[model samples]
Target: MKKITCPLRWILFLFCFPVVGSYVCAQDSVSVLFIGNSYTYVNDLPGTFGALAANLGKELTIDSKTNGGYTFQNHTTDPLTYSKIHSKPWDVVVIQGQSQEPSFPDVQVNTQTLPYAMQLSDSIWANNPCSNVMYYMTWGRQNGDSQWSEINTFEKMNTRLYHAYMRMADSSDRAMVSPVGRVWSYVRANYPLINLYNADESHPSLEGTYLAACTFYTSLFRESPSGSDYHPGIGAGEAWVLQNAAAAVILDSLDHFHLHPVDEPTQASFTLVQNGDTIQLTNTSSRATTYTWDFGDGQSAITEDAQHTFGGNGIYNVQLIASSSCNTDTFSIQVTTLGVHDHLFDGIKVKTSDEFIELTSSGGTFLIRTFSIDGKLLTEQSLSNKNPLMISRINQFQVLHLTDSGGFEKVIRIF
Candidate 1:
């Protein structure tokens, strides 16, 4: 039996096109610091990200200044906390208040606390310059926890806290909020078994820890390694996807690559006759825009899709910059050549607009003469003439060629 295959173009069209969504790439390694309470420390929360990054061929290190029950106030007063941010460089510092801070009615808990986190964030940025700070918005406590009794409702408290943190991040623009709390809500809506609490119903279980890892990974890295096929086990594919997603997310988030539309080809592939030695450029962007071509020659630029000839051999860089109102992009290529020596003074052609009739060479100078088939002198001129020198004006065209100052001739025209 024979196997059948789908066309590659169709496959590429389906998978390669950009969707409305955006993702951050984590190509480079990341140094992360988690600043929080047991919610962050218990069950080795930071290791999950490190483990996942490793799966994706990334080296991720998670260090922290954590206390078992530290709140935003504790972190502000803790000398050890300040020391960690300054000790070494960090890519991101994850900061959060006590999970119950949002449940308070005074709102000053969040208002006062966010500033301290931001202060720490600023210090980190001042030190690292390129580091990003993220606030981890934790989930609501168990349905009947004592912390919620005075908060009126767990749901309302979590929502307000989430929004408070979001507002703080938005105002500063120096921090990003990872929506793990939202994902936790999303998972709980579908899966009743996803609750983290043991029978005591206060803390999370192994399953709960895994869920937290997934939420953090997805929001922070823009992809969840577990995918839609999520289950309880922590094995091969799950681990690999999680780690790679972390690397991809972190890398992409930091380095931005602005792209211009690719020049449309006459076809997916093209062939050019070797003589003309020019590649015609086209605007393939959806909108019309101006283009500038730097044919990689250290020469002047041309504004049109004109033909060019190479004088010698080797690779040359060709660069093009195109711009639209929305964005601008650049493209470059190196044109390599087979360097064989030859002289065109023997039989070269020239049948272009008079404005483009200049000869360039690396050797001897050239003179030009025009004549009829009957040897009647039509026009004779100095080959070195660099002005508006007119040639034959006959209607019945024949052949004309170019000659060197030494009288060697090349057929410049055959018509």
Candidate 2:
């Protein structure tokens, strides 16, 4: 045989490798922990998670701890240890040194601090097992202070911090960096006057905080902020701005790496009462390849056809899921107990003049019956092969009795 090789072989192998790998890494939910100082706690950054959850329709648990001016040195040097984080489980831990430490004149302080932060992260993972660590790369103060002259200006100071954080995070396979600083850097380029801090240019104002909140929401929740009357995009003036640069960094970093898991299957359907107590679900979508049924009354099925007999007077949520190779649709049918003469029947016009009652099946089968006050069935007729029955003269305080060909008795009381 000739020594010929196929070019398509390598491509097929590469494509199949990831698809097989994703199945092994799919997760139901993600848990995150935020560890920072006043920058994270000042206006309760973690508190905004609820709003993010409501907006994105995602359920995630976030725990955060903050100190006013604590640095990595303070964290590793006793007094304030990782005691609170020792016992619980976490999927990801976000850590940041004191906001100013990265740009400090003494490189020794930052050099010493990075190792301690990494050590603490390792200890956290050792205790919890399956956890990843991430660093929050913060920005410099807007004011160009004399102590940071080596950084030239506030912008340069923040830039150095961003690069340094990334280098530290990239060194270890277990750690990653949230580019909150890069987001700020991009924003500062467009709006030179837009400082996230207050008049001191060191702390954030309400507008600054809102902007920061948007970045965090987008980064963690994967939802973009819709410019409302209150919050406009970055194009609007500072007063109308809602999201800050730090948040944008985090959001962009997340987007750069597609981190969303594969969607789970869902099913939806409508339920119909074929007879008084027998309920049947009809698949609305034509594409449903498989059906899963969970009838609220302890009935379940994995077949396309699902049938249930409701025994008593109560409300039940009948859930049906229809799924295909591509997607799944879920629907819930609420079967409620109804008094014979429920108001829903008020809109139905009666076609008879005597004390007549009509029984209807969801499959369009209908029967009419006339009854005496003592439950005596005077006359009965098949009104329609399949439809709701039309009865007249059904006044207040009367009982409806229906007798099927199978000798099934359905009793409905008119109030």
Candidate 3:
């Protein structure tokens, strides 16, 4: 019994709902903050979501700042919303846009919805660089929009909402979309007896909220909630249907929702080759496209490879920072060039070629080993009586530890 033609119009109602309420309960816990309108505050969606998380043996510290009919644009301007974002480092922040705003024309959505969504997202990252930004992806109005001609049906409105949410999530940071409307579409087609609409053919009935809660559970945990014993006021059979639909729509298509395949952290490391007061830096970082180096003398450079000269050397702590779109890593080392010159080690002649190092021993069985500055044993070999020893590729400024058969030691500094 979808809406045919209602006599009334409903748009933009503002009522800031407040609720009264954390523990180290489960092995997995997440802190989520919901910012939306009645769609989120009605059934206490955050509370319901927390209950579902606890039911599944996971913990959720849920909170919300909901005012009826709040839009993403409104949140962008509201001081209260900014305060909430800066309150703490939320593990995840769920942004829900106004019901009809996203379903409007594409131009309207791009102008009104997407930009503000991006603003909010930027704020989220600025506050906590590691926080995950998620869009709630509300369902279409139960009946449809009576005022608009193009989206006069539930199917049409739902499609537009999908597109808008997807656009918001398609940014470089890659936010997650819960796809609640997508799951709602599945249920309305498959489970008719469950009235998702309360009375005005809009907003969510208890069943609708439960359905949303199930959808969110799957979206957040990436697991099906079909067998959870805490269905609350709904029958187990009905709840199972909702959970399965969520699993089918979201769980089955996780990549579509941008949920799976967590972001890989940036890798940062480097090696140095020092010649007098000048040193050459080779970037060994991985999973990073950009790099920044701190020469520790109030000087810095943004490049993959760098050569910096110290002003009459002491010890310099050189650092390299490697970064990607969503991740950052840094590595640093202490380097000195006080007395860097050609030195003889136990009368063993050393020759340096482009990629290899050759060592000649004057008729003695000594062990030759190359080690990194951090004392890691890079390579080791026993030098037989008088044969020339050839060492494969080695970084400049690397240290070589030499010991005679009598266990006497000499250290040769090479660059």
Candidate 4:
């Protein structure tokens, strides 16, 4: 799939060519299957998410099976949802319950939402161990749930909904929550001009759906959708409002909503600068209080930041272990100590824009290798005679090691 650079053209393309079920089964694509009620279907939340992904130059496949006013229990009992989970490998399976179901009392939610959520999560993991079960925490009714006397206001309803979804996610190993409802609360409180509710005061209006799409994009991709061009026919002005609203809620505190999958722990990230045979490691890990450094040469240090000198290195694996009360993670980098042979690329210039890595030089064939911050090689390509080479989809936070045939090397970090 070629990248679409123009936002307007991309929006046109999305409307002209609506994605079908057949279009979503592609190799190496990020596949998400949404299973829920009308909340997941109205304004085509999955389709909106697809457009948002395209805007960000990501290959995404979205498919949803939704029925009006259906609960998670109904979805668990339905065979189609089960078959879809088993039919193909999905990167994410988003589950949304009926609007009022999660806001109900503890006894009701425990007996209703929790059991069905667990059942659905088990089915998803059984089908694909890698699939992440995301609970779509939906919003309270526009006027609040009249049936539930204990939750008479939107604030109370959303509060209950938040706790219920959090409990559900915390109970399971593979489950996480996408706090779309919380984003709605923020929008409603701050942006009064943007009406999220429809005439019924329950289902989302177009703006509401757009906000939901932005929240999903942030939750699933772990990237903010603040400047995405795909607006799904909504005016650019309104789209901007919703996008900012989504970012303010989702990106401000991602851990509050449990956006990341349970098995994926916090990452240990650091920057390294080499001078002669000594290397300096700067610890920049998040949510970690302690650090352990391993130079991979029988030498290690227990500090947040340290300097290590190699005996006489060809290539050594340097590892950092960052830990907190909740999680522990390790990051490794292969550092090549060339003694006096380390020369900077004098004429080479490297830069990044959006997803592409742009390399510029007067002339020469260069070996460009992309690697994770941990030093795992991602791609190796030789650019011959091409003064500028642009590599796409290098969007994650990582390091790029560029070496020319003349042995000059440059290391750049993308964060």
Candidate 5:
């Protein structure tokens, strides 16, 4: 007597599902929502990130809905997530999948992660045209994904994870990747003493969560967290280390994560001259309408050409960010300053032209050393009986160390 109908079945499904609360929109503040599973909730990433932002004097409204071991497919099918996405004018919506889902083979990723990511991104944009969808690129398991033969080693799994998240971000217009996994890779490789994983090797430890929070801070604010006062209950020393690590990997190269501010390409270039403790910055950028400069001494400027005075003598990493409506570029240089009376290398005159570094000394053998701003040595040479040694420009900017045979040394900035 009763005929089973497809429409009736769908209605029953909707009725049986649990109701998710509607997210209220906020005004005059940055608002973000996190959607994922245990990886996002274990250490309370959203809360920690909010605290970090607060410590930086920024107001961020943060929310999250996470379930244990839930995948993107689950989120796509869940009515609560759908309601949340469609209910608010969110500034950002962060999405992360099951830890193992992204490490699967390409076919599996296409069949599973890609489709769900596209759906979520579409929902985010459809609901709030100005909202940004950030895909949280999670790290591989501490040891590896043993359940799958294709992802047995950490390197293998991480490689696959990187490609998967990149693919997802590239496929959508409003999507960008957080590259939290890449940050983990950097920490593990460089800071082996810092353990990011818990005993289970999958969930993040407090330090790991702190790093993630720092990454989020940089991504959302488009500024480095190096000077933030928040430590999130961790020791100040360790917090500083984590903050710098995140900045070095994320803020230094936003393009690696496809997190540039705009879609059109732009370049950041600048030259600076130090007069005593005051430095004047000249912006030489292309295809840019806005400029932001971080003087690397807890000071920042927004003018096209800015001048800043330092209080002490030390090396500072100065960053210049140039942006257009759809794209951004970054350039950085290290500025070293000394007192007016200090002369380490007396008689060593340095001049820079468009293409070469012109150096003149008092007719003796001198050792020339060049280094990147990050303190990496790039070139080393000894000049003997040369009146004016001309070295081609190695990079946009570098530090040149000149040491005379008599043991006198001088450090100069080449721009």
Candidate 6:
């Protein structure tokens, strides 16, 4: 089978995209500090998240400065919270507010919640300028909050929570949201059988905490959690579904969240077109002066656009390094070329590049679904030969399952 590699897209604004910030791309040992209240403490959300990270082969040093009913305002005045912020050069700090306060009226939140959020975010950046501050976008009550007349349903409450958290995340130049709440909305819609609420209908149950952990894992790593083997108390199948929901929401549309605001480094990207044994390269890098290409077969080039014929038909990792005086960025993809018989699959042509997966059917309308190597659903759509479907936010490995209109099914692995 042939492979279409879609490299991760690094955007400057989100808290963590595929290749943004030094902390996000670190090889291992990501320190995360969660500062919240019962929502965080319930079911040990931080610990759950840490375990998920470790299961995925990333060591996440976890700590929390939490107290019951503590809001962002409460943390602002609390000395322990400030101490935690200054204690170490943490890679990421996740701060959450009292669940109800943010969903309140904007007039009240702008004063009581928003400013305090900005103050706390400012403190994180001031302590460690490289520290990535992520807002813990909490979920809504299972039912709506009866105390608020405007938010009388789950949807209303969640909408309020979403807007309120976005308000907090938007106020800072160097802050972004983990978006656990948005992921919760996805679970509620896609997997209603999973109860994310405690008996009180507010705090997270063990399963709910797992869902939140899954969300944070995807946010921090910019990858899917479906590959992990640990699920704690949740069933393996259910855990897989939760992990899928996290990836679908967090990774599929990461740019919708504000992740970073310090000056962006140069952005690097490129595309590949292969025919027979020769591969053509297109340099799409922005704000860069010099370029370097590694063909993975030991042959390399320095031009912005070049072509190379491989020694034989095999798999090779193609890499590009785009650099400027102040900074540099790199992107790589696995390229598989044939020494003869140039063909573009007359049935369907599926390709991935620059954070997107594009599928175009030539012969007929087909049902197409893409998955991670671990079998987590990434994108699903129906496209006739005329209209191609292009999805944003693709992972490193994808498995495409296709079904033609005549009811013929085929599965192809993409490397």
Candidate No. with top TM-score:
3
C-alpha RMSD for every candidate: 23.9, 23.6, 17.0, 17.8, 13.2, 13.3
What TM-score does prediction 6 earn? Answer: 0.59
TM-score preference between candidates 3 and 4, better one: 3
Which runs of model 4 end up more than 4 angstroms from their true locations?
1-28, 261-415
**What lDDT tens digits, residue by residue, belong to model 4 across residues 1-415?**
1111212433344455323242343334778888886677667788777877787887877778776667889989998888778878787888888777777778777887789888998898778665778889888777676665766788888888887887787665526678898899999888888889877677788999999989888887777787888886678998988888778777756655556643453447676656557777777564456888999889999988898989995788899998865578888887877665444454555554433666776667778887865778888877655647777743353766767677877665444
Number of backbone collisions per candidate, in order?
15, 17, 0, 1, 3, 5
Q: How far is candidate 2 from the true structure (C-alpha RMSD, Å)?
A: 23.6
Note the Cα lDDT for every prediction shown. 0.51, 0.54, 0.74, 0.74, 0.75, 0.74
Q: Give the Å shift of residue 80 in candidate 1.
A: 1.1
lDDT score at residue 329, model 4, on the 0-100 scale = 83
Q: Clashing residue pairs in candidate 3, if any?
A: none
* Model 3 lDDT per residue over 1-415, tens place: 1122322433323322352222233453577888887788776777777777788887767768776667888899999888888988887888988777888887777787889998998898788776778888887777679778767789988888887787777652458788999999999998888888867777888888988998888988889887877777778888889878889888667755667422432456675655446767877564467999999988999989898988875888899999987688788877765543323234576666434777887666778888876777888887754677888753443777677767765554454
Taking the tens digit of each residue's C-alpha lDDT, what string does model 2 give over 207-233? Answer: 555566566555554556544234322
How well does each candidate superpose onto the true structure, as a TM-score? Answer: 0.48, 0.48, 0.61, 0.59, 0.59, 0.59
Return whichever of 3 and 6 wins on lDDT.
3
lDDT score for candidate 2 against the true structure: 0.54
Q: How accurate is candidate 1 locally (lDDT)?
A: 0.51
